[model samples]
Target chain A: MHRTLHPLTSLCFILFFFVIALFGAPTTQMVGVMILLSAASSIRKRKQAWKKIALYILPIGILLFLVNSAFGAPFSRGLAYALRFVLLITPLVIVLLGGSPTDFRLGLRTVPIPSRLHYLFIFSFEIIQSLRDVFQAVYIGQQLRGYNANRSLGNKWKNIFPLLLPVMLIAISQGLDRSLAFEFKGIESPAEKIYLRTLTLSPFDKLSIAILLLSSLGLIVASFILP
Target chain B: MITIKDLSFRYKQEARNSFEHISLHLQDGQALGVIGPSQAGKTTFAYALAGLLQKHFRGGSLTGTVIFDAQDQAPGTSEIGFVFQDASLQLSGVTETVEEEIAFSLEQFGVPRDIMRERIEEQLSTFHLIGLRYRHPKTLSGGETQMLAIASEAAKHPRLFILDEPTQALDADHVRHLIDFLRVAKRSSTIIFIEQNMSATFELCNHVLFLENGRQQFLGTPHDLLNSNIDVSSLTLPELIDVQRSLGRNHISLLFKETIEWMKKCRTSA
Candidate 1:
């Protein structure tokens, strides 16, 4: 819950929770745990909590319930699988909404991914953000240029299509041009080296990592014994 | 310093040279102001000097030599840095933070670990961006973004800085900051400024070079260029320059102190 957790540790915790939920025993228990995590995050930021559950988590839960009811096999078994999916996704949603974009990049840096791929990831993220802005701007521009009655649902959707395609293309081209400029500025040059100072692993990181290791080990032992 | 002798260039698709027989020289520590109507090759000349005409761009045939700091140099020489009119095109950072944006280039040079953090921190404070170091570059006001670009390039410490109408995206306040920043650059580096804002040009540059229709119309000290027999009404000069011109004041000194003294002389003579 503390914001002081290193970005890497937060990422590790989220990934670890999902891996266990997807692969460990008692899927329903994992699902409950996931929902609990999301509910906890929601307490801090109510709107984000509502959005995560409503948009992705709730729909997933409903689908699981329908499937379990129809199949009706170890009724609890179906419920458990559905619960697992919900639990698997909760930590991810919490992490995504918890920090600003820079923290996201910093977390990614802690991973073993290549730097070029990192640049592309950053570039795409900006492109998406810019595309959203461009569409809104174009809509405002359209209204200002004399298209008044845009209140009706059908008219609004139609207005969006015309606005969407052009903005999307412009955003794509702008992204490419910016990427080329970065290349010209030598962002891709391997010869250009940066010295990264070693970051000390904090107690929070050690604890989260320990929890992941212990749970994963427990799952391995239980699966062998139960099998 | 730049000297172009009988220089001519034509884009591959175009029929004629954009400019022919062009020759000009910019002195050290002097700010050169280039003015011309559109399609007059104002940007083309600036590009040619930076060697970007052939390096960064194509579809042009250039036959001329460009000398930088008394030495012939190729495109993107360490001695010269360029600023386009569009600040967005030049800045490369997804994060909104100004410090991260300026660090983009220094990181490229592989600046020593000992200096990187200090340099980044210094630029953020010097450009009045300390408080906004964490703010997004895309969210920054037009002037702040321009200042960010200037700050980024300044960290490189290029000897010759060429700004191609950098004030176009800026407002009155930003324009002044840009001029003031250039005044600081002029103290240590020669600057070639191409702008339609003559008032800005008059305020900062002592040396003026006028380009009209891709031809060098006038090149001299600001005093002679404006005070001579020239139709400057189209130039839309600042009110001060207009009054000086109407009165036939021959010495329109560019130094702020000198201009103040000249104003006294004009009032006394009248």
Candidate 2:
């Protein structure tokens, strides 16, 4: 809910949620706590709540639930596993859309981590984003150019590969090209860097991070105590 | 100024050279339009100029010399700003906003805070990007993204700027603005423009590099190539040039408006 927190603080909070979801027992208490966090995020941006649920969170959760149950896991356990996925993913969605994108690399850079690792993180992230854009662009371009009065699910399904192959090929080539541009911009240089705005965590950021830590620890302890 | 002599290159495991025995001298403060059809090695040539061919593009037998700033620099260096064909891919993935995108390289170079702020402001206004300064580059229109890419590179103020088909995704108005920007840029930096839009290229570039099938077919002024009896329909020749070739009209126009005005004059005179 605190949108103006330092990007690094936001990152810490998101990572805390992820670690909790990944490692914590799938008890009612853990799920309830994560649900509260997600609900707060959704309530903050009510307009995007439906889209986050329908497009990303719910479908993935449902798919995982189905897979787990099909593999002979008990119904309750499968449901908990699915809920955990949703919980872990919620923090990232909340933070990205809640405010301006975190200066993620800079946030990571402020730590004792080496520059090259952050560089790799930033470069790889961009490449993935670029590839996604290429695929989307190809799909949109195909739809616009091949504007036919198609009225069948079968036709739409069949049309997918025709668009996908070119997108894949273009994405691959562009990825390689971008790697070259990455070095061209002297990103590989070991030069001292300056940011447009250096990140300085406020007292509020520290408080938020502290609260996130306590909450995560409390949920873990509560998970064990609940049963 | 740059001199590239006896340049010939082929990609790894490829049987043929993309371009062979190509040689040209780019003068200071000149815009040379590099035009060719598909698969004519325009992108390859652009890369070579940028100095990427040496290390970035691996396992290629590249011979000859590319001398810029009195040094044999690589394509991806600071001296030669090569705007890739796809502006979207070339974007520094770290920046969240258009302002950040423009400031990205400046930050990398550790440019002083005061100067960086001044440069970002100037670029935003110059490219008509003031309105979209806070907007993310990924969400920008095709033309706006392209302009932002150019502005980002221009802020670095490279000695030689080579753009590979920058106008491909742009509309007429954006293309006009880009050309106008290039006109001013040509006063300071030598520009190697790889473009498909012949008329626009002709409008901005004085020297032309016309390639056909991985070879240099013609290297001269636009007027020289236009006046020559070369039959290439795929190339987007201006209507004025076509009329000049057919009729005895000596009219010169690289734009539709100019062509229309010339036609009216010719009709009235007749």
Candidate 3:
């Protein structure tokens, strides 16, 4: 049976990779983790994930290489940072593919975060959920209104100001409306909130976390002793 | 049931009050159609009734007792389901998929997972949105989003349901569906139906609350508003309502099919 792991498990795994990227030697182990994580994301999500990595990571990584090489730093040093960036991002993509926003929030709620911040986290997802579509509609609306987006770079830059303002205004106004919606829905009730998705640390989850932490600790020891 | 006495509200930034001394008494299961020109304070009135004026919009100055039964419920609670004019505003926006959006309100109300699933499916099919169940609600067209908002609110089955221009983004077919939806809803819920267009309200509503310059000009039945000497050009009815009115029919429905049947009956009776 395909049992879904708890969201906190992925979160903890992601934190482990962050630690690895920070402390571990720039070795084949990091590369292996990167490859495994990137591949583990479902094909449908990985398609978009790869696009983001290509668009953002490739440019930043190449830029770092150039800047470091220009400053007389070893080319491999810049490559290490690029790989570290990959380590930081891959687990995030895995979590997005494997888990959901609700699970993520519920998992966060398990942590000792402030109540206001927790509320903000939940409220923000709501805004993003609708604002994304509203922004698209605004773009289409502008196009239909004869303001084409596919113009010269200078013209496109000019259009961005107007486009951005309406999108922001719509988002802000709709956000206020959604706050009211939350109130009407009893989301902000002083009453205790019941989370439907139980966040149990399954035996597999415990085993996975233990294995992940041990591997990172072993890597840390090896990095210092091998040198 | 709701009772609003001596209600006067003014936005902190505005030069004048949105509405003043607006007293209303809505009995259980009564559907009141609020019609007026632009800036008639229909929305403000809705906010006041929903207890949004003071509770949510804190900067505003509001005076009056807007009471719902002896229970004295707080403003904007689960008892009132408001579908705002901008349909997107009505959406909770927290859920990823349309199905989740429809169920978000129910989840907040602490509904069982199984029932939430059932109602989500039922709403999806009822709103003809079964195909878009997995799609992001924010990515939907205006009509689809509006339908989602309505379905989401209806799923909770709140006692006082307020819809502000719910059909503004919808087509005639969807408007018909809404009227049918309201037909069933009115048997239990009190409806505060606000619309610039008088189309679906003619069938879905019983009482009318006509406002002008934020004053209660008339509060009576749909038939009374049609028969009374009120200039309704500003209300913006579809062409069919204008034609039916021109033909001396006091009771005109925006639903073309129903209007056609009514016309046939009138001709045969004559």
Candidate 4:
């Protein structure tokens, strides 16, 4: 019952807009895809998550529009481009707000990267995991050692330094050994090259891709017609 | 096929020598088990012997003769391939599949494409890891990871194989598999199996060296140390030794056989 999204899919969700924009996709299509992704992610608690994104985005979007009008570089183009940026930003906010760490892990797994760079890629996440452990270990150790950590600024600040060094050292030593263990198991120095599994372009994905393509073509057509 | 005399080294910042007055000789096809308590310089000794500590990690004055195959050797070209205690740390590949793990090493060794493919298949089945070839090592259990480590190392047949506590994280079944692999490899290569697992020491060691507090406590056959029971408190041993002692069977062959029989009985009962 514990379903997890693949790391590749998470990555795709985050970067799909960037890819679209890079490939000269249109703003409305990008916006539509981003909204779709964000909406999908926020399904469980749609209003709360979606509301937060809108609040943060709406103000900046208005400011950008105002600036574009003042400078006046093709109002439609500016609007489209500004919308494209918004599309790119929404998934990240949704991912950060709505997704669990497991989602990020799944996203990494789904990354369409080359095999040779896999360890390096995974290692970056491992470093973050270790850092998170370091904090939790230190906090637990502090609690066990009878350091009272009440909900007060001064008291919390006082306990910080006393617990910091020991935790850091323990975490560093353990992390090194763990990293070495990872290498020992042939994870660090694999014997073969591997490639990401070929992506099956589903109807949804194809629809998304086609919309992006057509949106880009429409932008080109609109420029010619207007001129 | 390794000779070291008057070898000594000190880390860059540390005042005391990591190793000093170290002299040893290992013959081809001979297996030597290195034993020591935690941080008692077992890894340091192995690293020095393999020329990794001196060459890569540590920098210090070392005045000694390390003659590999009776030839004067430089650092980093050591024929000894090392597998450290932590199987997870030793792996450096990014792929999720077992095939990639073995193939990565073979590629590093510069084996040709056709030979690499053949060797990959051979090792996959040899290590009994063919079923999990497409699985990521991270998803594997501890024993499977250990097996993968050995399998990857086995892909590269080094002249002198140095394994540091190779079976520490493995279960009995996987440990037995590793011992079997080492025993087979011993036919051609000299093994320097550094471990705290005394049962494995007794089972596979032709010779054993006990180190404590950065000093060599005893060096002889397993029977000598197990029988004498002197100056070995610093060295770690398997729990079965204590069990056999309680069973009052200190006889070398009887103690060993009894431990195996007892393990078998437990397995069957379970």
The interface root-mean-square deviation of each model, in the order shown, is: 3.1, 1.7, 2.6, 6.2
Q: What ranking of all candidate models by DockQ puts the best one first?
A: 2, 3, 1, 4
Chain B alone vs. reference chain B, TM-score for every model: 0.85, 0.91, 0.87, 0.86
In model 4, where do residues sit more than 4 Å from their true spots? A1-82, A87-122, A147-227, B74-80, B112-132, B226-230, B236-270
Q: All models: lDDT?
A: 0.70, 0.78, 0.77, 0.67
Model 2 agreement with the true structure over A1-227: per-residue lDDT tens digits: 44455776777768777767765666643665556456555445656865876787889889988988886778877777787887777777777666554645456656666666776777677777666777788777777887442758887777776777897888778768777777657676566877787666778888878887887787667777876
Each candidate's number of clashing pairs is 6, 4, 2, 49
Alpha carbon lDDT at B124, candidate 1: 76
- Candidate 1 global CA lDDT score: 0.70
Report the CAPRI category for model 4. incorrect
Error of 3 at B242 (Å): 4.3
C-alpha root-mean-square deviation, candidate 1? 4.1
lDDT of candidate 1 over A1-227, digit per residue (tens): 53545567666667666656666667536554755665455444657766877888879887886788675467666667677777767666666666556656655655676767876888777767677787878878888888664589888777677777878787777765565446445565565545323234577678877886777677667766875
Off by over 4 Å in 1: A3-8, A27-47, A54-56, A71-73, A110-114, A148-151, A164-203, A210-226, B15-20, B69-72, B75-80, B117-126, B130-134, B169-174, B227-234, B247-270
On DockQ, who's better, 1 or 3?
3
In candidate 3, which residue ranges exceed 4 Å CA deviation?
Answer: A1-5, A25-152, A155-159, A195-201, A214-227, B70-76, B121-132, B237-270
Residue A159 lDDT (model 3): 85
By summed lDDT, which 10 consecutive residues of candidate 1 chain B come out lowest?
A: B73-82
lDDT of 2 by residue, B1-270 (tens): 788898889999988899888888888899999888899888898888776777677789889888875666543466667788889778887778899899888877778889989999988988889999999788998889899888888887777888989898888888888898889988988999998988788999989988777788888888777766655565877666777657675544555687678778788998
Candidate 4 lDDT tens digits, B82-116:
78777766665344578877766665445667877
- Evaluate model 3: give its lDDT: 0.77
Candidate number of the best lDDT: 2
